[model samples]
Target: MSTILFHEIVFGPIHSRRLGVSLGMNLLPYDGKLCSFDCIYCECGFNKDFRTKTKLPDRENVRAALEDKLLSLRREGITPDVITFAGNGEPTMHPEFKGIIDDTIELRNRYFPDAKISVLTNGMHLNKPEVFEALQKIENPIVKLDSALDKTVRLLDRPNAPGYSVAKQVERYKRFKGDFILQTMFVRGRFEGKEIDNTTEEEISAWLELVRALNPREVMIYTIDRETPAKELEKVPVGDLQKIAARVEGLGIQTNVAG
Candidate 1:
């Protein structure tokens, strides 16, 4: 299984294809993956494959570590573009998520006032009041909506929630009121002897309808950039991605494609 795990509360000032030079903060366990959705394209691999036997870092610890890292970066004269909430799993799953966002905002205001705070989420917990509010507090609340159809979502994201449905999630996304960034992963492959592809005409048509309905501020369309847990998966070509972007752009919504 190809997987990448961050073993610290503050992991990187790594260059993100979409978010720029980002400093990552992980609220999940440092030793293993703990996400609500077991995405085949997840860099952290499947949840069961990397089950954590560790506790989540508390709010204070996350604040402290982030501060220390920011201080270190300041001394080096390296300013990150964004402080990203993403790591081993669904960050909103952390109990102190709302409080942590508060602390992070204060810290960012103190250390890097120009920097933005972003959260990369699967949107599984958007129905939770705390999670929804916390996401709103961030500059980029990038939520994943890989496919707009129930069956495709089930096959692609494999969400842990038994009653996960695209219809319910679309309504949940509407709560953002076009304030959030809609992220979708485009890929095609076979998993567990089942063939799958979200770049198809049918998939794209359905997804475009969702985009039209939700009317997000931005749409981020991309393909697998790293080794995925599912061996048969393949990346959508940059040309194909650009074509999709054109369609999204036609909808009058800004679209960012990371091939």
Candidate 2:
């Protein structure tokens, strides 16, 4: 066992390859995990057998902790680029997600006036009015769309719900218009004996079409950075990743390849 490593409701001014030096707010339990997607490559480990009770800190506590951390870092003359909503699992799963984001925004403005607030979500709750409103307020609303194909997405993400469809995700994404950032993990791996790979030509083509339709502000292409739970997964080479990025850029959408 990896000891299920979350220290508190607020953890990390950790290095984020995409978001820069960021502060993380984990709305999920410090010990338990709750997410709609049991992603095979989740750094937090697969969504466990725990009940769906979300151990989210209250909105005021999130603000106070984040403000305190920001002020402390300011006293030390340290600057952070982004204040992010992320953690052991899908952040939108928190019942008071909208309130948390609102509190985080107010605190960010009070402390690190220049720092951007970001939310990394699985797009599970995008259709909800409150979730959408909160997301719209954040500076970086990065949503995950690992694959456009229904079956491929379910396999890679291991969605917990009965009717988790990629089309529904795409529909939900439509509400964001051009405000959202898109992230996709390109890899080949097997889960529960299902052959899964999103890096195939057909897969990429389908995904690109969706990207074009979404017209996202940014498209992030990243393969695994650390050891994933699955062993047989193959990393998409940087060159290949760049090749995909170029295609996205050609569509006039900003694209970043994780180096």
Candidate 3:
């Protein structure tokens, strides 16, 4: 068994593959790990055993903590490259998500006005008026799309019910047109007894077609990098990821392999 990563409100001016050196806001909990999906490759492990009491931090508390972190950075003369909304779960799940984004954007303007703010959303609420509207204020609102087919998506994402299908997600992306970024986590694994091998030709073809249809500003391609609940899983190698990226690039879509 692996040791658990503690839940917390903020964690790192740490380097990120997608976003540079980022300061994270963990709205979840110091012990909570909730998510819209129970992905096998999640860095925080499955949300089951770590489900939080949903004792979300009040807006004022969140602002205070974020400000403290920013002020500390300023005092030390250390400036992060990005202020990110990410933690143990899907960020959009927060009840005050819009307000949080507004507050974060405002703070970004104050402390590190030069820094960019980002949200790592699952896109489950991409169609929700509230969620979509909030994302518009950010400099980079990266959304995930691990598969193009409904079944594969269901297995890979394991989203909470009431969230709709791949078609609905594509429709949501249409609203963003070419502004939104698409991030697909590639790998082979089994979840809840279902085999999730999206690296296969059939699955990749379907995914590439979706990319062509969606026409996002860019596509981020990467695989598992941390310990997950599903220990039986195997990580896809860098060369394999490059191969997949090449295929997507052939469609004339911009691709980043998280290198």
TM-score of each: 0.99, 0.94, 0.93
How do the candidates rank by lDDT, highest first?
1, 2, 3
Task: Report residue 158 deviation for candidate 3 (angstroms).
Answer: 1.0
Over the stretch 1-259, how does candidate 2's per-residue lDDT look in tens digits? 3324465777778888888898888887776677888888777776664344645677777777777788888998988899888877888978888888888878778878899988888998887899999999888999999998988877788888898898888999988888889999998767667777888899999999999999999999999887676666777789999999999999999997885
The candidates, ranked best first by TM-score, are 1, 2, 3
lDDT of 2: 0.83
lDDT of 3 by residue, 96-182 (tens): 888888888898899999999888888887767888998887888788899888888777777776555888888888888678778
Global lDDT for candidate 3? Answer: 0.82
Identify the candidate with maximal TM-score. 1
Off by over 4 Å in 2: 1-4, 49-54
lDDT of 1 by residue, 1-259 (tens): 6679999999889999999999999999989988889998899988888886898999889989999999999999999999999999999999999999999999999999999999999898988899899899889999999998888888889999999999999999999999999999999999999999999999999999999999999999999999999999999999999999999999999999999
Q: What residue pairs are clashing in model 2?
A: none
Off by over 4 Å in 3: 3-6
State, as a TM-score between 0 and 1, how close model 3 is to the true structure.
Answer: 0.93
lDDT against the true structure, each candidate: 0.93, 0.83, 0.82
